[model samples]
Target: MGRELLNFKMFLSVLFAFTVGYAIITYGRLVREEIGRYDRALSERVQVIERVKAKPITVKGLYLTASSAASSRTRQRIIELIKETELNSVIIDIKDYTGNILYDSDLDLVNQLDTERVVMREVKEIINEFHNADIYVVARQTVFQDPALAQAQPEWAITTEGGGLWRDYKGLSWVDPTKPEVWQYNFAVAREASKLGFDEINFDYVRFPSDGNIRTAVYANLEGSKAETMRKFFKTLDESLQRSRVYTSLDLFGMVLESGDFDLNIGQTLAVALDTVDYICPMTYPSHYPTGHLGLANPADHPYIVVSNGLKKSQTAFAKAERTQLRPWVQAFNLGAVYDGPKIRAQITAIEEADRTSGWMLWNASNNYDSRGLLPDEHAAALRSDVTT
Candidate 1:
């Protein structure tokens, strides 16, 4: 009996040892898996933070449409222009007035909407090339003027009194600016652009429709005055984009600078823009100004006087703003007067003379820019170096 008891005790000891060993092994495996998951999540968060923290560049840029950027030949010519001239940046259309997304997007909603036109198939490669050339690239996104989105998601669109999609004078449909979903959609695009390595995201047409029959158009979600609603939108945009850490700019009508508190009934004001964005790009194209502007019979005819006077009028407000810088878009395409080298130079001179202004961007719809008004490559390089030093 004593021997039997001793053997039974030994067997029980062995069972306990095996059980303890198995439990330890299982626990260790679970702990390792948890640790691995934590590490991966932390790594991903770090990457996102790093990716979005691009420094703002002093941009002397030219606009390139999606078509121009997609065409290899045209893109090469534009790059050549940048290399030869003082141009250090290029604004490429990520989304245009047609509301077509120019690149393949990973977002499910974007895919579901079928908005990816894929004009720039090699978008990442293209951005890499620009980065290789030491050129900053900006993603231009047109919000609120998206006809495609309006068509795809009519509930989020501005409607006519007849319960149809409201069309602007150009017969283009627009999304309702008051819709939060629309805001999120645009923010998603901006985030994607940031991921794609754009140094900045420029929001254009961020306003209510201006050229349509205003009396007929209806906004179901509009909560306040046009300007107040717009201010809220700007605030939301700033907050949403802060996590991405990418530089943001808003394109405003140049008249906003001189208009003061008046929002032009399109819901944009210089004061609000200054408070919201890293940069405020007033579309100060002189041709767009009225004939009597600045006491000039034709404001576009005098590029220097128009730009200088407009910028000067806003200098006080710009000076007071702690954030944001003025970067006006000068006319490069001919409208009021033929824009030649001297004409372009005059606009540049005006920008340079303005206080609290950063740099200027040339606006030509054709993307046809030359070295006429721009400095030589070496001169611009030297100037940039001097500023940095």
Candidate 2:
């Protein structure tokens, strides 16, 4: 009987030892996983804190194409112009019409695009140069008209009835607005631009392809109307950028001011846009206006009247909103009428007459600006006198 008891004691000792060993192994793994999760959460918190906000300012700016900024001579000339005139800001293309990124971004998502294209070797240096001259810098990114992105990720492109990627009249492809990836990609670029110290991030081509075949096109993932999609995009982008300091602006069709909530069938309208973004930029280039616009024989022929009326219509539409500011894109190129110095000034004058003070941007595709209209009369006189001397 004593021997039997001894054998039973040995069995209990072995069982207890095995149970203790199993518990130690399982508990250790759980503790390690908990530590890893804690580290990841802390890292994310740090990333959120790192993004700084852009300084707010009233911008009277000029658009700069990627090549214009890449050239040393062009950049110097732009700097001189900014110093000489009442100009305080420049909107440089970070992602242009071709959807090519102009600068290298460290973000993983941008890495794929950057590998295919990079326009500037010294973006930060140029921005610092502009800042030193007291010029505010804005990063202009084209949102939906991204041919490169469409080509790279075909699933993200707009689909046709034939189950193929739809191409606009210009043969340029566009991403569907419904894709969350599309929104995320554009916002990621803006986030990186904000990190580069852009005072504001301006989005252009935020609309759908107005040139594509309308009836056969299919928005595979869109759950609502075009205007609603764009409004959601604007709101989502705005909310996403809340952690950053850079201001948000959207470029809209000049006629959006006159169209009410119709959205031009491209998903952007003045009313919904006003409630979402920080600044509303209507491409108020006189040449872009249609004949009989505002009851004029040719709206382009009357720059002051066209611009002033557009802003007034916009003001009447959103008189209650205080969040979004109105800044119009004026003509610097001679597309319809003679956009001389006086003609350019007409648009600025119109902005003032309309009692909108958000300031304006000059859009000259070639970057050749005649400063006659921008300078005050006294300044122009002094400039002429100095030249003679």
Best by lDDT: 1
Runs off by more than 4 Å, candidate 2 = 1-54, 113-116, 376-389
Which regions of candidate 1 deviate over 4 angstroms? Answer: 1-49, 379-389
Q: What is the C-alpha lDDT of each candidate?
A: 0.89, 0.84
Which residue pairs come into collision in candidate 1?
none
Which prediction has the highest TM-score against the true structure?
1
TM-score (all chains, Cα) for each model: 0.87, 0.83
lDDT of 2 at 293: 78
Q: Kindly give the stretch of ten consecutive residues in candidate 1 with the minimal lDDT sum.
A: 48-57
lDDT of 1 by residue, 1-389 (tens): 99999999999999999999999999999999999999999999998767746566678999999888888798788888888787888899999989989998888999998877888898988888888888889899999999989999999999999999999999999999889999999999999898888889999999988897988989978887888888888999999988885788999999888998889999988776776988899998989998788788998889998888889999878877888898889789999889999899999999998888888898898887888888778966787789999
lDDT of 2 at 60: 86
Q: CA shift at 193, candidate 1, in angstroms?
A: 1.1
